[model samples]
Target: MRVERLVPLALPRGQKLQCELCRGPAGLRCGACCVTYYCEVEHQKADWDSIHEKICQLLIPLRTPLPFYNSDKERNHGLEQQLSREKHLVELTHRVAQKFLFEGKHKEAIPAALHSLRFSIHIYGLNSVELVPPYLILAEASIGLGHLTQAEEYLSQAQWTVLKTSHCSDAIQSKLHRNLGLLYAAKGNFEESLYHLANDIYFASCAFGTNNISSSGGYYHMANVFFRQNKMDIADSLYSEATDIWHSYFSGLIDVQLQTIMSPSEIDILCLPALRFHSMELNTIFIPSADESQQAEASQILNAILDIREHASRQQPMKTGKVVHALAMLHYLILDIPKAHELAMKALLIISYLQKQDSAEAIQQLINLIKSKPFYAK
Candidate 1:
């Protein structure tokens, strides 16, 4: 229920806040972009030539008043090409907000999220449900920074907006419930967290099929709640359901894997795997214990699922690792967690790497398309 923070370390090792120019201990900020820090005026000025110039360009629009992007202004080409300067600025701000959120730069995310929310009101009325996504992002950043009260306020506004909407999408409803669940979880209100999480799962199930991977995420979070309560049996059941959904979702994607001859001894577990879970999640979280019976059960479960897993692995090692990893996590709930944690981590690396590869490929394709376009200048 608690939102986990596993932001990858971005700055150079051994130091996080160093002068971009001189690599010195730093506190001074660049006046234009207000993103980079420097140790001295000299270092800040030096960066002006190499980095600040480009950064300042991106931040320039923020200085001007952000106006409403009237959707009514679409041109002959399309809405994308017809965006007014104000509309473009809002889009840019929204992108920056999301990027900051993804990078764990919560402080920076706040202003961008605020800008997006403010501008969104012009497009959709102030009380419109369309404002919820930005509001949710603001709440997420606030929670990341431990601003619990501020986060609550944001969620409250969003909840009110959602109530006012006569027609809200399941996706939006799911997100709203998910954030409420996580917020209550962070506040140590387990019962409230459970309620919101249950609602989130219900809506997500409606939007995405019951066996879809996204719905499995809802199941995973609910499992975490059960695990936190020390309800090992229920937690294990939830974990099993989540993994089964994941396995089912990926089963049809790898025909080559299905066709390949799989050795029973080298069976792979097929599914999607997640990393960056909190130690308090309980499912894969470690605690010390040595039980021969627990170990025996773990072994038996793996053996029993081997044929099924091998069938999945012959097509995609990435997916198989995830399925096995998810199963290992269920063991962590009912058996010795430390061992299961190890297996989960190993599987996580494989799937997470593949995920990155898929993302990078997509970005590269976009870049190629952009470059391939014919450019015309005024």
Candidate 2:
């Protein structure tokens, strides 16, 4: 599996380089893109195949320092070229970082995020409001990796930038507050987290209407905080609201897609496959808990997500496997080991068939979890 790919920063000479995939002491570098380092030949090959091939040449400009221009006209033209290139690089790295973060690959996200940060600094100066987005990305990635202190530093910087700006816009404020909320939650400061999350929701609702899909993420995060605090009623209400927003957004696409489809097999394939269950067996092994209602609500939301992803994945088998894997994780979260294992195996089958090494590794981890636990087997 490909590991974290840290872009080289200004460091002391003789410092050991980290591998692009493993973060081990790396001695080998990619011949095509010397900027990428690896601990071994196999890791180098894996990184190249997974992501580097597409970005190799694009990263070349970052490695090259801006040329010196003595003439005023030449300096102006050179700065213009630098700005255009930096903008493109920033967008590319930021998009890649967001994708990794979405897939829960936090370690892998850091390098791309750092690259985005570097380019953003070049394009907009060190303390510009435009740099807030990149800082937020780094903060979220750090939070995902459980680096709370580092996350705090990034969020603090973002907050300072927004505070200094005369008109930072509600959209940016919403995102900044959302990251602050997440950071506080990770630090176990529930009260502070909720306060920030409330601000996040308020600003998001102000920027985008209350019913907009963009505000759904704030609702979802706030719901999680409530769920952790055992405020089930509030959590359930928020979850329903968030899912309802998502369902409406996705259902619109689904309806439009359905109208153009004429094939019965295509429609049939979109229907989620039924999991085999022995009710009597499950009842004997699993006892109902007071939180069963919450679990049921969670299951309902996961099913709705699966349905939406199923239709969306008609042309993307890998996404189907990803959603199945997510469904397995949800079951595991709700303490349904047998069902989690079954769904995991199903996900593994789909991903393995598609020959996705990273996804297959994730499925294998879920299988390992099933084996390591003491849950009753069906």
Best by lDDT: 2
lDDT of 1 by residue, 1-378 (tens): 011222336545775566654457776666555555667776555445323453455544544444556465543334343335446556656666655665556776665666567668866678888789889888978887989999999999999988888999998898789888878877888899889888888998899867665565466667667768877667656766766764443333222232332335323322111111111222221222333222333344343343344553235555456566545444443444455455555555655667766523322322222222223011
| lDDT scores in order | 0.57, 0.69
Lowest summed-lDDT stretch of 10 residues in model 2? 272-281
Per-residue error at 235 for model 2, in Å?
0.7
TM-score of 1: 0.49
Specify the poorest-scoring 10-residue window by lDDT in model 1: 271-280
Q: What ranges in model 2 sit over 4 Å off?
A: 1-28, 35-53, 65-82, 257-378
* Quality of model 1 by C-alpha lDDT: 0.57
RMSD of each: 17.9, 14.9
Look at candidate 2 and give me any clashing residue pairs.
3-21
